[model samples]
Target chain A: MSPRQFDQRHPHPRPDDDSAPPPAGSGAQARDTEVDSLLEEIDDVLETNAESFVRGFVQKGGQ
Target chain B: MGVVTVRRVMGIETEYGLLGVGNPAANPMVMSAQLITAYANEGMPGSARARWDYQDEDPLRDARGFRLDRAEADPSLLTDDPQRPAPEGDLHRVTLRRRPGPQPEPATVANVILPNGARYYVDHAHPEYSSPEVTTPRDAVLWDRAGEQVLLRSSRLLAQIAGMPEIALYKNNTDGKGASYGTHENYLVERAVPFEDIVAALTPFLVTRPVICGAGRVGRGQRSEAGGYQLSQRADFIEAEVGLETTLRRPIINTRDEPHAESSRYRRLHVIVGDANQLEVSTYLKVGTTALLLWLLERRGLPMELAALRLADPVRAAQEVSHDLTLTRRLDLEDGRRMTALEIQRTYCEVLTEAVQHAAGGEAAAPDPAAEQTADVLARWADVLTRLGDDPASCAREVEWVAKLRVLEAMRRRDGLGWDAPRLAALDLQWSDLRPERSIYSRLVAADAVERLVSEDEVAAAVLHPPQDTRAYFRGEAVRRYPGAVAAASWDAIIFDIDGAPALQRVPMTDPLRGTRAHVGELLDAHPDPGTLLATLTARPPGPQT
Candidate 1:
């Protein structure tokens, strides 16, 4: 086994690409919006019937 | 349209420690059960009061669209309440009555619920999360996140719960001395993949898993010299064995042995890696990157060229991986190629990123734009780790956590303690003789034997004895003390608490007869009393064997 190294430290540089796709700003932002919209709809349902949702969802996989 | 690749939901379960303040006689398990029931009855959406009292909550829903409860009481950990009103002045306080409330029906309490609607609970003393069988790759990732949310929520809730000691949920295997505890992760693989093939491909990366996924650290050197740094992220504690035989001794990556009804079929890979990372980033990368590697294997992108990548001492390897960055040492691959820990990790991430991109696009397909970006982030993370090897002064939270761990480990060593040291087997040996039916003498002899052995090992290890050898010696001592537990060999653990005592510590095997009797009763009630547990402790019995 390699011995452990504990003292080495370096400052991390910022990413060079501002236009990086998917996981970066634009793609993640778009995904976040979609998730928010979906969550809102679910929340609306929850406001009226939290118990039914819990029962139905919890029953998906047997306890 | 071309066949769309999908991800499935997966999750993890965490158990909490329970306490009863002021009352020294409080039973931790009963308290945990009560706390769990209380949380469960608070309903899927906790009332404002419930949320204030309990700290954990998750917005994600499980497959049934039910919110899962990520973290709950282990129903095993025992502790005394420090603040219990003592009519008489003594350390052990009186037992308290169960609080009045609507208890969760037996069925609901049997398994805990996560905000995601997933259920998790304790099987034996350990908290277990059996991931919901996933249907798509994306869901698998989401499930892991959901599971983590539960853990985070549970951690907070446990902190808020009254009369409980601070609970630490280790995500790694035991040091093999007392109880080889650890965290486990599962992934569904194509059934056609043989276990041997999976092991062959996975071992190399597993050796280097710490690089991209290792939470950064700063700590004293593993070598006993006055002052050197330890670089590997995984080498903070002493633990051996990459895998443990489950309670059933089933292969770590168990074979379902059943054919799937659907045209698309796969087997689940259950991996037990002793990694308990404090950082969410570390947890995310640990699960995410490993899953990607599994995907890489499924796509035939893994290279088995490094067949000789065996570690002479995996226990050492496990410890070396957890050290903070001041230590520098080279590991020799099977081919005798010496590589720095960082170099190995960088190469692994680079290889995996390329493989993921290729597989995502299909045969010679254009790289998915999303994968390309993720690959870059992973590469940078690895690079940062490599450059920052073991610098204690470094300020990254991940690095500091490791540093603090190293400090704790140092304290253990100075105080003659071994994490996951070999005394565990001896402890099991004594506990083995402690069936509810066994004579108190047998139980006392077993528990005392373990406590004595662990104490000796701790002393020896404090004098700079090697951890692996020390643990091995403890295992040998356990066999000598209680030959029956070893022969019958039930690795299951029974947890109980004395009526009084605030330390929240596991009972020493060397305890007096009365404590051992209580422990035995607790064991019998919680789990089936093992018939062979008594004789299992002796190393070599001279008399007639059971």
Candidate 2:
């Protein structure tokens, strides 16, 4: 095999436009807000169950 | 979605724990070399007579398309002289960086390439084994575990030779002191993708990945941070976001540009954030998911929704997340929002699940092996995170940290011991003991309390052979059949000393997937001798130009 065979590191060269990742900038900023909002809800649940959370930490793992 | 087209090369390099057996004052460097010698005498693969070619090793090369000044590279390497007198105390106290007389001849530096296509050698006081490249995550698991078996067998062999079983090996990163070794993973990525894109998309995923795969540690901190039990052992040691150094100022995204394959065609993603896992599932997912994420990053990058899930401060986040036993500690995301590591990981999981569904279609179809493995990893990753979300204790049997914690926590409850109890620390260290008779992980496996993926037979076979689908085949076969005449081997090629030949013949394995068993098995069967094999390879036009 030639070096050219391994040289193609750009992953897949052809990506269907429709399946490509979302556009950056405004689109990214907007998506970030939604993800952050979703995260806020989960953080609230974590806070409510704070006692169980602390217990889980030490009892679960480190070694 | 286009027929699941992905198969990235994966490999691991680990520094095994070395102990001074029988003699407490025994020098570790001397003991380590003895272990290698014992294994070599036992006829283990990659004998000292067989060498490792360092023609292409450039640790100063960075993934960001540039090379660091050679002087800036860490000089803490395996430059020690075995014949030299040991320092008065603490052999390591003598800074290896000091110019110690004239540099030892490069030929004197010891290296062995095992028949399994792995490299076993001393890396400054530590015995490191770098596994051969494999195509699948499962293969990665098999090969990494194979390294453990090699070390374990060597440990036993040393015991028999020295007449004492005092030398026990542990697959741990730290000595519970201020020092840290590495359980480093490497993945081949498309070099066309900008380095910035990889760092941006992978930093948070890598930081939080330990939640699932972390080998739980006993005491907290390394060098700087204070003590506390946490999810990962190596987390506290990391100090940078991007850099070429590994020993000092460790980076989350290592910049070591040693691709091991063709340089321009491949940029190895040297991952150092992960823990050395005990559970099979933990290691499988640790490698499997990372390969999937790398595939996605190379192809399309993370979706906008997932891309913005970055940590505001990665170094601080990695430290807090490790000690956050609660696994719910709030981390500042780049988007000015506070979230737990679990939630951030869950975000990536959710996006990946969608990608899997889209690629697999309505009925979970993986057109290729990579897609199939990626699909399996996503399912397991999602389940693990969900369990970690509700009750981490529920997933104790599957995740490495949780399984170890289950065993440790039980002892705590039964014996009325605190987390800092002497017994607890002892138990923690025993979990990583390489001896099956002493390893907590081994006990767990025997009792069927934890998941087991790779079997003992496969691991034993892997010890004596190399992967059939990569250049490792040629490397391993040549060494296995001709241990003496095989002059030296490297990831990219092997140099064979053909008897009566004009010059030492070199075979370039530029392509990681080529020169595999399917490609070279016939040639190997046809020629039992190195001279004839070299002649065949040279006469053939199918392989890379020598």
Candidate 3:
């Protein structure tokens, strides 16, 4: 996923661009934007350190 | 009541394996009875014999068009008993104080809805722990872990009771005797979205998911060829793309069209394809990614490309993904394209990213909480896929199958045995055993070899408290405050005999987001008793039903 516009806390933050949308509620906007940056770090490690996701495991019978 | 909450009320029901008992001749039925009795006998504060209402259940009503046979519709028949009461009283306290005698066998399925808005019950001869409704994947992990804690504590307590050998629980699907239980997931989807659309979209995604989140298996073929290790334990068991029966003719997309939310507004997607993951990371990713895909399908109609993503034969693809650990197995897609499981999974991830970006790019896109969750899912999904694409062993910490494979591979090399060795199969069973000391997964978690998503503190907190954002808040509070008054409780409504009223009052929680902390906290506080609370709640206008 491409890095998007976010404040210091939220990395892939919600779209804060809409000042006041008629249909959407403001309850969701209140949460802290702290989950994305950590995901970015995990993203980096998984990209490099964590290797293949489906290797080393095989069926019990000869395939 | 937000823009995307119809997709947020999610929960998981896991049937745990009972081991460590039946030494000389430990009957599972007898052992299950003991474990169920242990919890019921040692009743917690919110414990009562609150009846489980089965009025809304209609499993036979397929998401497609026709109603299945009555036998197929009644999923609760597996655990239903009208006389069974909720676990109440201070049995745990009494058991601790006195010399525990032979525990009485429970007459019916011991269904105890915990204070944390989750249900702990014995179903189909297994102690099943169902997590409370949660808004996101992260909460799903925390609450799911809380269910594990429930199993662990109950198992430990059973060990203490005399005449009862220690009980062991495993968060796995299969019992290795060809009989498989389920790790069923329920997700709220817009009822407006066609059920056929859901099956078409989810079939391929569910089939390929084992490549990333599968709990590795040691043996092959549930009732067929049994020599090779498969990627997932549940794969060989799923025989069709869509079906109403979970026990017989288990399908990839379960048609248990029992929408726990309001029928007109929301439909519950009963996902049966997933494996019960031991790794917290795998659990998080499994739930998070699936929720995102569902949201994408619900908000925007199922894309044509997604339909094109379907496998030529879904059952074959599901099994192939498990058997082919090299990530090189190619599935014939609906578009006549043969794609590897890794490729198909990555494509889903890529589409998820594109969809999120597309939504964000919209002009009046509000600051949605789902955006934050979607971000979490996207990053984790990408990370796991990258690791899986690289050298599957590297993901040993986060991916459950990899971690178990590493343990088994090391043992096999040390013993100089083949994968088909019976000892290796035993080791595989030992890996999932929930006994803290004996469980290899527990050992891995202790040694910091497995990646954990939620903290133990979060799990503990969830065990005692319901989430503040869903109808679970009200269900939990009602049970907590009026254990004696609660006549029955179901997903969408609660039947309570408030103030000893002759007739039971039905409190309908049609909107999953309405009876939340923000919506009903003050109301709950104002009316300290069940009688007053029901009167006040009913008097209030039907506002914000969304």
Candidate 4:
């Protein structure tokens, strides 16, 4: 019923190490490789004419 | 009835972005109608393309206790009337002539109530698929994904035709131009709750919900005029805090109060602020968390602290929260306190968690399936909020905006391009392409880049059948078994015209919880014919109902 009761009954679980920087070791390197490969896949399928495709995709307003 | 959980009658309506490939000038009205016709004729051959019954619809009736004058109302708000093209127009006649098979009448093809109990029709210039009513968030995601399958199959069917232009469907909100469509969420709330209570309690929650469920966008403005990434696609288009208009002066909390059920007991909360999400967890938590809050509101009224957390300017707060990519932007509350979007969301989650525990008498174990689902939603909500506070990149698998931002950032890094790059906007549009081959989201799912809650089999089954727990089962079964006898159907009634009946037999399903498979399964089987079914239903003595 009140914020005081909420704090006592269920303590908020704000992550303790909130300001820890993002990992910059092998994990970051591995993620980079993954993104590179995903971008490669996207390149194969992305529309060749980006400007026209993006420009031509007009739609009538809807609810 | 004992304790309110997250389980309630809910549905999702998605207005898919349609485009004619290689033909920029194609009429969307005709193309949208053709897409529906192609699906009903070819995708679902034997099923009846029932006309949408507009007898119960009243779109101009506002939930804030007044109805707008019909003349002053926007033309798009006139949904009760049939939207059809000219009878002998060139588009209609040419489309009819090109088809090689026995085609449905152009008027009838505009709307088809599927065997899955969903409505596939053209609203405005977009092809919309309204999922059948379901009780849980999981089923909501299932039927919503079933709609994606419906679009995919319909597009495939149209592709096989020789001369028909290949129409591509995007499960997104905007065309990146000035126009923005919608993906609306509907929740059934008790009529006793005041409209002011809903606005006061739910505004901050909706303003901050983008942190959890936003389908990310590549541009900052409605017309993509500004070059920056935002958390939500529909956020910039929202210009009002509350209104009855949908197409113009879009609102955060829509006041359209046309409850398709018993009006005295319920009001369907027509939510229009959400983006069309492709991620399952986003859709799941989007519906789940909101339902839990409504349950709290219905059972115990708005908690005092929640009312005090109202934003100073909700309309401005909505856009600020969307544009803040850091997820740390502080919003001003009416009490002169500042809270980040994550903080406000966590407050709601914590309160609901305590309420659920109290409902179960402090027992850790769930008492029922519904409670168990609520527990799951709370746990996911807590985990996502914690991760968002600590490191947003960790939620790439669960949160849609994070997942999409990861992809866009990677593309930006690889090409050495800014957010204004045409390729980035193109990729944003392609992220929601319904085709698996071209969709970036699909590729993420395939590569285990994103998390999934429902299986493909579950979504596929939902496409062919309705959930067994709601009245949709009765509606879906009637349409599937006796397609010929069903003249029209709506959310609350089904009109049956038998071969030798005296007149059209109307079956009123005013209650959303009634007409389940358990209530009418044996009856449906015993009376295979519509005449016998109607006779037995009418002959039964009326009893006291829930």
Candidate 5:
């Protein structure tokens, strides 16, 4: 299948800037930033070492 | 007439479809990942208020049970959405990072809950929520039902894409015989207690859950030491050895001992023996009944009666339970109360009836009432057992066979194995240890891949649209693998087939044992089609081998 077709099926494309409004409160905003950072790190880790990360996770009972 | 103290304790986790392997076919994992991404993008909206039964702790509570709203509101981990969509309802967007290669259409859909205070993602593959703990069982039901609806809604987009296989969540541990599976559950224990008492009190109940929840399996003809035969809770023993050690090796009760709390006393009993029950009644009973049992064991301090009442040989008892279902074993308790299995069922009902009554009332009482269906199902299951308990010759093979088929199909259609790659990987996982000819199975997979590549054909298309009479083609191929399997010289005894190739010969199925290497070669020689072999061997759908 073409890349675009696969994307159409799963649709995890990067978030466009105007897609969602900011967090409700400043506290919520800060927490979202933290989550965003962690998500970024997770993406990096998954992209860099997909197989080993999965293997390690499984070995650790998928915790 | 008195102060009704309602304890608020509840938690929930929903394991979603995860797709690490990439396939275009609507694999649950692929579709789930995609949905999650979409939900995330849409800004997970927090429901206005928690469900009445969702027993989330007041974010205001402090160490001394005082309000903490002044100092700091406990930062919300999840966006609380009371009106989440049904499993078949609306869609949500989740975001996934772009990969380096030509990115396949966002291969994952996640419902984005960007810093929402209500519902949020728990893990990459699983979604979880800790409802405000509730005092009444009635309330817990709402949270459970709500969670189910949310999962169903979140899963709709993916399910539709993947041919909408009816999906279910298990609330028990393993398929009785040998396999270990998930039994998702939640509980509200005291926030101040020792882990020792927790393990001591819960271990026995956790270990023996299979007794009530185990779907019965046929006993392989080999007699046990107590002269009782055993079969796996799973239907086919062709790919798995049905035996006592097998059950013991992969235990139903797992204790990683990781308490998901800051303090030791607060531990949610995480159970995993659940089968994916199809019937709504079975699922309701699966969770509601087991939760009641745990509630009783934890609060009432019921000692492990089944273990003590256990037959001289467990394998025998297991076999008897599997075979006749009604043969009652007597369990003698510490209080000099000697009860047969039937009596225990009666007493269990009385206790649960009273317990629920007391909980319904504000009075402290001895024993707990049987949850709604536990008593009736136990009695009926026992009756079925008793009716057939005396007969050794009369076979209700058809009923048992149907039950086995139901279990088999339910297992095969789980959300996790929705994709071709993982489904195939799962078969490989199941057969890793039991392959008759390890090298030969591996070689066939390798050959299939090469053949497909050489033909420039896609395996998915191959499965959805086959080249010929699938069953006969597979059968012929399988027969070819066992050229010398059955020797004409030994018409009665099995002859060893060494070279794995097709042989047109019939072998008696009654042989007690056959040489392993030779059998493997012979079986492979039969040249059975991969599809048929997978279906018969794994009780699963055949998928692409990559």
Candidate 6:
């Protein structure tokens, strides 16, 4: 199935610029932009002390 | 034609992973209780006092037609009794004693039956949300998402309390340490279908189900000591093919026989092998396909191919399937044949597809919602298995493991880091964080990187109202309308202590299909007071009361 048909069946989040579809063959570039922005966002809010944070996350066993 | 569909009584229970922002040493028991209390007391008023009625719960009774002796049972198996944190100076003493003054009263609200027909309570050290029963998988995903909103609200309210440490909840199964909690799914099955039949027919399906719905893990072993990723978070933790114990020797098919319904007719299949999924599509298919499989077993006896497709060692195969990211590892069968996990899943899917068509008798019936949904699940199941076989990356929109792997791979490629990087492990944990600002999955949802099966409004509405098709409607409505008189409630009964009644009024809802909105909505609306409602219900004719 085409991406549009799949999106129609299972709804995807509408992009910010929904007024017009991107020009041909821009799908790869659009995905790269999305990944880059996500990484940039993660860099700001990710926990600073990664090693200690990972080590200290101890949980009691549960069912 | 016999009804062959995914419509069955199914529900999900999630045990959230909680962490104190700065106080890593805080007692999880106390913190979990505080989270429940915060939600009940401040988030939803008048729900704080409705205690859970555990009279019908018999956790030791096994579906294998026997009961383990209480002396031999694990302490975690004794779940009927009210669980209180150990008292002061005990072995498990409360560690939230940082203040110089006298110790404050422990958070007393351990359990509350919500207006949404859910049980928000503390199960051991983690806050558990047991959703109300829903008959369809789409509703299953909606209500499960509602449970997440419950946790998010509880966290926000608890953080506002004076001197209360900020708590973050994760919709995940493991802590990347050895300790693993559960995100269990329950399906109502006919008791006439012997337990052994279920065990035999369901083992291979459960062993290979992770290819579609696994919430990816960053490390190999349960302790995260190994330096690799896997498809499932709970695969390494599974040690048994079938057993009664859940905390130790975790089983693929848990034999807990607590139906919480008419014991003679229904047996609630307690499934503990699944990960707590975040994507809506993952949760939808996880429940939908399983329900369809159970329908197939109940209607038509196990297909010949399914009967012959038993794994040689299901426990080992479960882990092998998870670890094989290439999606091409062959698993050995008991019949001396080998097949990849994808092939096994495809066999089940194809069997059900043919069964559904045969049941229809090549005649087009009028459009039925249940049959349509079953067809939808079958189509999606086939689509997912086919896509996974082609390229696992193509399934990022609908598969939880694939979606998570994409984000992790993106980060690794950008930073030139290996699987052992602490940043990647931390990112894995934060992906499940409840806070939208901190969760990478939430960021993906916002970026339209994921697909959604339901809308935000549907989830929000489910948070306030229970599904109108099950006995949960009566339970949720009674709690919502007459909060002052609902003394306690369980799966099959509700106890009301009206002011002038000689004794407590007990109403037994033995049938899960009855007591729905169609049965008692008007009765509930007619009587604003619990006393009159009880009187009217008792005064009705004694023949087949709705």
Top candidate on DockQ is: 6
TM-score of chain A of 3: 0.28
- Model 6, B1-546: lDDT tens digits are 236678899899999999998988899999999998888888777642678877667888899989898788888888886353212121111111121233454557899898989999999999999999899898899899999999999999999999887999999989888999999999999988878779988999999999999999999888987888899989999999999999989999999988887678889999999999998889989999999889888887677899888999999999999999998999999999999999999999999899888887856666666777787888889988986876566677889999888778788989999999989999889989999988988877876777777787778999989899898988888888888888788777777877766666667776787778988888888999888888877777321135
lDDT of each: 0.34, 0.70, 0.69, 0.83, 0.30, 0.84
Residues B29-64 of candidate 1: C-alpha lDDT, one tens digit per residue = 443444444444443233111111010111121112
List the candidates' TM-scores in order: 0.46, 0.82, 0.82, 0.91, 0.37, 0.91
Hey, what RMSD does candidate 6 come out at?
A: 7.2
Q: Which ten residues in a row have the lowest lDDT in candidate 6 chain B?
A: B90-99
Candidate 3 lDDT for residue B145 = 86
Q: Candidate 3's residue-wise lDDT over B1-546, tens digit each?
A: 234322377999888776544352355666666676676566354455565666554545567767665443455433333343222222111011121243463464467677777877766667777888988887888889888887777777777878668766777877555778889999988888887788888888999998778998877888425776777979988888787777777889887776766666777888988899888778878888888888888788888777789788999889888999789988998778999988888888897788877766744545665556667678778877875776566566678888777666655655577876655565566577676665667666654556666667777888778888898888887777777777677776677775545466666676787779888888778877878766665566452222
User: What tens-digit string does per-residue lDDT give for candidate 5 at A1-63?
Assistant: 111221131212222212453333443334334334333322232224323322221210111
Q: In model 6, what is the error at residue B94, expressed in angstroms?
A: 41
lDDT (C-alpha) at residue B210 in model 4: 94
Off by over 4 Å in 3: A1-63, B1-7, B20-24, B71-109, B362-369, B541-546
Residues B1-546 of candidate 4: C-alpha lDDT, one tens digit per residue: 336478999999999998888887788888888888888888876777677878678888889988898778777888886353112112101011111243556643788899999999989999999999999998898899999999889888888878887988999999878899999999999999988889887899999999999999999888888999999999999999999999989999999998887777899999999989999889989999999999988988899878988999999999999999998889999899999999999999998998877877855563665766787889889988997987687677778999899888988988899989989999999999999998988888777776676778778899889888888988888888887888888887777777766567667676778778888888889977877777776667221011
Arrange candidates by DockQ, highest first: which order? 6, 4, 3, 2, 1, 5
Worst 10 residues of 2 chain B by lDDT: B90-99
Error of 1 at B229 (Å): 9.9
Residue B487 in candidate 6 has what lDDT? 77
Native A-B interface contacts kept, per candidate = 0.00, 0.00, 0.00, 0.60, 0.00, 0.56
Instruction: Give the clash count for each candidate.
Output: 115, 8, 25, 0, 97, 0
- Model 6 misplaced regions, further than 4 Å: A1-33, B46-48, B82-107, B362-367, B541-545
Top candidate by lDDT: 6
Error of 1 at B482 (Å): 51
Higher-scoring candidate on lDDT, 2 or 6: 6
